[model samples]
Each structure stands twice: as structure tokens, then as C-alpha cells.
Target: MAGSGDAAKEYIAGSAAGVAQVVVGHPFDTVKVKLQAHNTKAHRKLYKNASHCTSRILVEEGIRGLYKGASSSFVGIALESSLFFGTYAHAKQLLQGKYEDGKPQLQVIIPSAACSGALISCILTPTELIKCRMQVQGKDAMHATWYSSPLDCAVKTLQSEGVRGIFRGGLATLFREAIGNAFFFCSYEYSRYWMHSYTDSPRFAGNSNLILAKDVGIGIISGGISGMAFWTTTLPLDVAKTIIQTDPSPLSSRNPLRVLSMVYRRAGLAGCYAGLGPTLARAFPANAAAIVAWEYSAKVLGIRGS
Candidate 1:
């Protein structure tokens, strides 16, 4: 069993990473969600592209519009990341049992990451549902009553659709997280190793020093690349998830695969990856910050064993 102390440290580190991720990425995320949800209708198309969408938000809603659903995101990511990193640490420890060596093989890392992702989905689904709803709504006066706040969104959702409604796209979230995280951790680990090897630096894995520029750079590159890897592979599912969560029609299918099929029929493959541009843009910096924060916080807490 992993020590409670170690688990607590992992949670703290992950929380730091989560905060960093959201602060850096939420604006991009808002744009991505909006693009994914609104671009489906040809007759009612909102924005032509990412830049246009961004400019409109800035002009109409200002910088604050870029972070429209940030409150739910902050809370969701913090809690989900804490549970994910903490769980992954313990799961990897158990899987690696007595190894006490360099990086564990992909076999160990994959299952550990998958398990952590699956568990965190329970927490992630509801919060993401709220965030997506808030993000998809425009700043128009007609939409003012949609959700006054995250709490109000939750209350209204509960009143209208009940508990199951809060977790509308949970199945897609499950597959996305479980599969995406396996890729995420694997890519991160390998990228970190490659960076360490290429630079001939020992600090990439673990460092006793309080701070090092090289180490932070390595973390940024590795985390950013890994994030891109995660989204590139799972974006279709994400598109499905967004549609499922935001569609106002009571008759819209809640099934992710079905949603994807529906989108495929309407707009073909490109439609399924509606928000690819902004997602990739957000993934790099957001995940870079997350890894840098996670590593530094872990070192400070004395929990990074490498």
C-alpha cells in the first residue's frame, strides 16, 4: 500500500498542476468547446475559424469571455487532477512493486494511467457538463437565463433532467480519459526520458535543487508534446462528448458513438474534429505548465522519487 503521506503529496502536486493547466488553458478550452458545439449547424454557423471566434469573443465579451466557464473548470480540474495523479502514483507503485529503478515499462504505466483515468471520470463528467454548457452559451441577452453561474447551472440541470442529466456524456468521458491518459502518461514519460537523454542532463527525472531552468524546459516540452498526443487521438470522442452534453433537443442521442455517427453523416470526418485547431493550441502550453508545476511541487514536497 502506498503511504498516506506520499498520497497526500501527490495530491498536492497534482492540484498545483491542475491550477496551472486551467489558468493557462481555459481560454483556449472555452474556444474549443464553443467551436465544437456551435459549428455543427451550417445554417446557423457562428464563427468561421478559431481566430474569428476569438476576435468575436474579445470584441463582444472581452477577455473575460475567453474564460467564460472557468469557475467550474478550476474546481473540476483541481479535484480530478489530484485524484488522478495520486491514484496513478499508487497504482504505478503497486504495479512496479520492488522495481525501484528508472522509468517503468509501458506495460506498467499504461494500466496505471488507465485506472487513474477511469476513476477520475466519475468526478470529471459532471463538472465538464457544467463547464461545456456555460461555455456554449453566447453572451446574448436571450441566453442570459441559461446559467447565471455554475451552481445555478447545476441546479437547473438537476431540476430539469435529474442526477443522470448531470452526467450526460459520462460514457464518452470514460473512454476518452481511460484511453487518452494511457497515451498521455506514456508520451510524457518517454518524452521526458528522451529529453534527458538528448540533453545529457540528470535533472529531467528528479532534482534536489529548488529550481532549474533546464529541468523546467524539459518538463514543458515533454508535457506539451504529451498533451498533443492525448488530444490528437481522442478528439473525435471529445467532439461527441461536447455535442452530447450541450444539445438542447430532448430527442438528441446521449450515446457518444451515435453522436459521432450523426456528425459524420452531416459533415463527414472533419466535423468530428471540429475544434482541432484550438485544442492543439491549448494542449501545448496548458500541459507544459501542468507538468512543470507538478514536477516542481513534487520536488518541494519530497515526493518525486523518479
Candidate 2:
């Protein structure tokens, strides 16, 4: 009962983080996907930049346009985050063995985070496939007749492609999540550690209010920077993932490296980083909200870090 209770709390905290992340980041993500979908030389470029993309979406679809696949994202991110944090929490503890009191070793954190990411990729792949398709649907005249909603998109995809179609970009997603999350967790943990070391003092240990405020601030900063690191290093893989998932051609190669090569040949190196602007812009704030929500909720639920 005690173990299950802890797990439940971890899931709840993670779910809170996920919801906050989607609510804050979905608009930025929509723009990023739009940019990636049309960055190829094979298609005429649509928007000039992130600002242009934002205005175009507004003119065409209103404020709701920026949130095209939000419904699916809310569900997807919530479940993904729940499992992610829970799995990481448990994995870190297991890897810690008997020395559970100290800061986790880099070796321990890396593999644990990687495992969490790989596990969640199973959920993220399908969710992102729906999201990318929905985002790119009405971006051009050729694709102006968009699916009515995420459900419609999923149903139509199932009708045309089957379960395999739904998981079309599984390999790309797996690589992105596994690699990106390793950097993410490592950067976050190290950031927090350094920040705490630089600022923390034993004198303030008794002041719970001050400690709470400091912790939140650090979490926000650490999470934001970590998010940027994740995207900066992995955006190419993400661009490849988006193309693989959204390409209408059934025969399009699902291999990420091959897709990247195709992108490079068509649009040069710049093509591989299609949505660098909005992705970096969204990374900090979205991830900041996520970490803060996760840490705060965990504190509230009395779920201590391993």
C-alpha cells in the first residue's frame, strides 16, 4: 500500500507537470511543426519566419490555430509525463542500491533517464504523429481541407495505414527521446546542484519559506536551461522525426538518418533545423513550467527525490 501510494503521487505530480507543459508550450510547438513540415525544397516555403508563421496561423485559423492538436497533446503529454517521472524515480532508486542518501551518480542518472525516455517513446511516437499531421494539415492550399480533429485524423490514418501507420515514426521518436532526455536530466541535475552550491547556506536551512522560494526559482532556471540543451542538441533528430511522421507518401523512408540525408540534399544544412526558432523559444518556458510543477507537486505530495 505504501509503495503504491508513492507511485500514485509521483504520477499525479508528473501529470501536473505535463498539463502545464502542454498548456504553455503547445502554441510554440504548433508553429515549430508547421515550419518543419514545409522547410523542404520539394515544397514552396510558406512562412518566412516564426513571426510570420504566427501571423499566418492567426489570420487563417485564429487563436485556436496555434493549438491545433492540443487535445491530443494534453492527453499524450499527461500520460507520458506521468510514466516518465515515475519510471525515473523508481529507476534512480533501484540504481542507487544501498547508498540512497547522496546525490545520484552521473552514471546512475544517465541510464535511468535513458530508460525512462525509451519507455515513454512508445506513447510519444503515436501522440506526436497525430500532432504533427494535425498541425500541418491546413498550412497550405493543397492541404487546406484538414482533419476536423485529432480523433478524425487518427481514424482516417487507421483506415488508410493500420496500426503500423499510427506508429510510423517510432524509430525516430525512440532515438530523439532516449538521447534528448539523457542530456535533459543530466543538465537539469547538474544545474540544480551548481546553483544550490553557489547560493545555499546552512543558516537558511531552518527557514522553510525561504528554502521553498529558492528551490522553486532554481527549479525554474535549471529546467529552462535543460530544456534548451535538449532541443539544441536534438533538434535535427526532431526535424527528421516530424518529416517522417507527417510525410503523406506511404513509401517515404521511415529511417531518420536517410530522411535527414534527403533533407540535407534538398535544402542544405539549414533544412535539418527547420523550426529552430520556435523550438528554442518554447523550450525554456515550457520546460521551466514542467519542472516547477513537478517539483512543487512532489513536495506537496511528500514524494521525495531518490
Q: Per-residue lDDT tens digits of candidate 2, residues 179-233?
A: 9999999999888888988887886677888888898899889999999999998
Q: Return the TM-score for each candidate structure.
A: 0.93, 0.95
Q: What is the lDDT of residue 188 in candidate 1?
A: 93
Model 2: lDDT equals 0.90
Clashes of 1: 0
Model 2 regions lying over 4 Å from their true place = 98-101, 139-141
- CA lDDT, every model vs. true structure: 0.89, 0.90
For candidate 1, which ten residues in a row score worst on lDDT?
202-211
Clashes of each: 0, 0
